[model samples]
Target: DQEGRIVFSNPASHRIWDGVGIEELGQYRGWRAETGEPIAPDQWPAVRAVRHGETTLNQLVRIQGSDGSEKTLLNSALPIRRADGEILGAIVLNQDVTEREASDAALRQSQEDLQHSRQLDAVGQLAGGIAHDFNNLLTGVLSYCDLLLQELGPGDPLRSDIEQIRHAGKRAAMLTRQLLAFSRRQILQPKVLSLNSVVEGLEPMLRRLLGTGVSLAVELDPALAPVMADPGQLEQVMVNLVVNARDAMPQGGQVTISTANRELDIAQAGGIPAGAYAVLTVRDTGVGMPPSTRARVFEPFFTTKEPGKGTGLGLSSVYGIVEQSGGRITVESAPGEGATFTIYLRRHAGPEGAQAKKEQRKVLPLGTETILLVEDETAVRNSARRLLERHGYTVLEARHGMDALRLLEESGRNVDLVLTDVVMPEMDGRELVQRLRAERPEHKVIYMSGYTEQAITSGGVLPPRTAFLEKPFTVDQLMRLVREVLDE
Candidate 1:
């Protein structure tokens, strides 16, 4: 067939190449350059197959059609031989590998996306850990700074310095809080909140932040359900997503945000638990992400933006919030094709299981009650003892939980409140609470810890109504919390 003549062609060849199907099967058997102008018969695979008495394969050479469009062929030819070993024409085969090539490319892209996602997850964990510890330190510093301001006179220079310290500390605390949110380690005060409402409330701010050049649109499903999560943290999630969308569109593009009610069944593929959820999606028409960048988008501190433009923790924080709230997230993007991020958070069934609203009561004086305070830090314990003694209460000091227990056993005095650290060398707050409860069941106890409630106790080990005061407590917070617990 290679003597400038065609041999055999599959029926699908016409369907694939549009027309040049069976008509030219045996008639058009010639080797042509991919240019399709014409090739000498000796240079053709089919011609070589017959002349050299050997098979030949055309891996992926493009062939021109009647319309000048290129068609790729995986062509193979074997010499057709007679019974006495005399060579005849060639039996050629052609397969269209266009769709197969496309599928393979898509599969490669998907694998790359998966790998990037995993890397981001690892980075988020690291960032969250750092934020968690930094938050604890900030909590102590900020609380004490506020307390210091109360002791300084209005005209004192020390008061101004303390105020500046408090302001700076507060800013640092906010950064740490963002980190904690990304890590899912912050003390959460979850509530039943509608995502639609949160978005609506943030619409004005988002529009302003996005500026006049970029357009913003919102699509809200009326049937969208509520999710159980800290309202502040949820708001933070929305803000971060909006900010990310804005950054993506520096050249000016549309940012669209939408929410809907979604249900993930057991067979769903997104690693989401089977449940009803509120789906939040943010899409940007800015510079779309390439396969390489999309993979690490959610990794903490992993950003493709020029330095000083990003911390790379925006998506990571979003990931942490959704995950911690029993939700999942998925991203879709292609190079120059824009991006869309979808977050699925478990829907709250109305407001039935919401944590009780914290009711603020009037601060009262800690009458003549004796308080036993156990702390390891010299400065903190001394400060606490002085603050309590000044508040008209008798104070007993112990360096550790064990020392406190010894004081309780030896001193026959009636101890009204047992304030102890949740983490200590001799005995933690949890063990001390158990011991005190066992010895004197009626005693009041206030536990303090910088970690989350889960981090402080293993499982559900702590008893109900056991008051907690997070550390670096101000004189008023400590006295007020103690008084409230004692009064109860």
Candidate 2:
């Protein structure tokens, strides 16, 4: 027994070893748990304990049973000595801790995922704030350019320069829209419509964008249900998905777009409520994403593309649009196995509706109504005043809400409309509107801001029926909106 041989094994040990005796265990095969190398007989904890009078504790090891089954063991061994310190035999203990180790690993991964999600949210908020302020500045620049272009004749040398300035401003405005989308603050006009129809209309454009190297396939279920979503934003989501799929398949592969109606149970729906959904999937047969990249695919400003090739906001915008529309998006991928993006929008039970009609350009209407414009930004305020004055409206400008209120009081509620920013110091547009309505119950108000309606008033400061304007508006937009509000 002192020669590192087991003299007796407990019934528990025998059961764990599949009824094998100590002799069979001595010949059993095993490996180091941390490294898959064979465990030498002399290097075993039990052997070391007896031969060298050493004590080994919590040495993780992998063992193979007589039936060729494997198990992970946390092993410990201690030398058994006589009263005179003479070497006797050794005692060993082993515990199956495989499940506990796996549980710990899962907890760590969840923590890491939560941390990443928080970081992404922080970045998105910062981007949204910057974009809001930038939109205000762009509004001033673009509005002034519009006024300049109107004053200039066709043959004027500076007309082209002003046009270029307008073009740049529009591009910047698009970028700001992307930022707002990623922040989940973009205003959406959701309607109940068939998702299949939206996909059908975009097939031609998608094919052309994917080019000849890639084959496009659309598998739309005719019975797919209608979903409540903004058609334009959904189109953007599809375009972004297709573009990403195309980029993934540089050497040429098939891109498939499919839609179906699904009924999800609580277990299947994840965060969303169990309900019927219109499910859309875009899949590619090209290089896919690794786990690390897939984990951060929807994070803003995170991109794997070369510099200047991507802005890294495509997937983020898609994420925002889906979330804002009360839908959910998920991606599945493995390296070299391609990728698939699945979007689920709640099925609308209401009556199906057609896409909202786009406003048609018509004769620009002029107004003689006295309007009070309150804005914190000087440039934006001046630009609005100039635009209104050129449209034959009496423009009364104030730097903020309180100043506007004072002006309104002095004017004895003679102003026809109060156009004010939703966010301002001293008093916000919401409070100012309350004061104005108290004075003149029939007064009209239009809440305007560079920030998204959701960001400015998540508490419902602006009612659903309130007239609101997004900043960076063209002169035509301003005039038309003002005329519309004044007429109403």
Candidate 3:
């Protein structure tokens, strides 16, 4: 068997092995393709074919070249025998299939990514539906609670109980908001803002949230440009990131919040458009995530924290907010190496602007205007009617848009304002308004809903100067909005 060595190799075989000839290849090492264990000389395909007079077919093997490069090959060997039943040598064939294996692996990874995305989207849709229905129920409870509070005396014993109920309802409302945020269904009021200012404003609260164990550092860019985003959503994003970092380092660590200006090319921006962006980075010196955990970190309801400790929607909501704001988010981490989350927001071509000042609280004005209230939900419709009637307005209730139109046509009364739910059966609020506008262009209208469709909103916001009222509004909110619309 020629001293248990390869005696000859064809030009193709030599070329496949990086120009190493048969004699030179004899010194190369081989390994099991699956487990990477070294193969002994006797265990090699050629050795078994020649020395043991055995035939082998299509065995996967990995060979290491002299330059430390590896190639996966499918090999076959057959014993060559002479006339006297003597074994001459062996013929071996190998095909380099490194590229094929790599391509298959990449395809599998792409499929997995697609499946994961679909799963997240399904969960988001479910969450949005649930939140929408919950908001309707909450509107009744909150409206009733506000009415009771308004009727109670300052010294009434039942006032405390009603206040507690109101507090719990508010908390539930907050949870619904979080769910809507994760589903990218929540309404956003985006404004041009300086990222550095937002970070600075939240510093005091962040420090308090981190407690005594964790330290906070801010490195803001002095010349950072303004970004168009919902200020409240951005704050929520920061709070979630900081809280996540703090939890990662239970024993405490330093959290650094920074901002910078970046101009990304197509390749660097991933699916987002290539443009100038304002970058917000949150880095922590806490235990980080492995590849497996990192892959699913943004999936809705996926959490590493124990039950009752985390909602698991923080990162998911963050992802939705950034995406809805026309931006992208990325994370860099490895096991025990800490983590860095970067948010890239498209730069707004405008000067930094101050946040809108909070309106001074004034006593809600009562109106005697004839208002038509249209809603599909009976409880919500009745509660709104009572609310408006208690404030001295003559309210006409309708089960839906068609009923409202019929009521308008039958009654010769000139309705001062039409307060209608945006989503309804038979006729949506938009269609009803369109019809009403045709008949009476000067009629005032205010659309209300837990969630509005794109047809009603431009870029997730109500049309400019259009009146709108979100569901679960308090008595004051309802009264003020009604009065404001009527005045306009």
Q: Least lDDT summed over 10 consecutive residues: which range in candidate 2?
A: 453-462
Off by over 4 Å in 3: 1-110, 267-275, 414-416, 439-444, 454-458, 483-488
- Tell me, what's the RMSD of every candidate? 7.4, 5.6, 5.2
Model 2, 20-42: lDDT tens digits are 43344566788887888998767
Clashing pairs in 1: 5-28, 5-29, 6-27, 6-28, 6-29, 116-295, 120-299
Better of 1 and 2 by lDDT: 2
In model 2, residue pairs whose N, Cα or C atoms come closer than 3 Å (at least 3 residues apart or on different chains), thus clashing, are: none
448-487, model 1: which lDDT tens digit per residue? 6554433334221344556766543455677778877887
Clash totals in order: 7, 0, 0
Evaluated against the true structure, the overall lDDT of model 2 is 0.83
Relative to the true structure, how large is the alpha-carbon lDDT of every model?
0.70, 0.83, 0.83
Write out the backbone clash pairs for model 3. none
Runs in model 2 deviating more than 4 A are: 1-109, 263-276, 438-443, 453-462, 483-488
Weakest ten-residue segment in model 1 by summed lDDT: 453-462
What TM-score would candidate 2 get against the native? 0.76
In model 1, the runs with Cα more than 4 Å from the true position are 1-140, 204-215, 265-270, 273-275, 305-309, 335-337, 348-374, 384-397, 412-420, 437-447, 453-463, 466-488
- Which has the greatest lDDT? 3
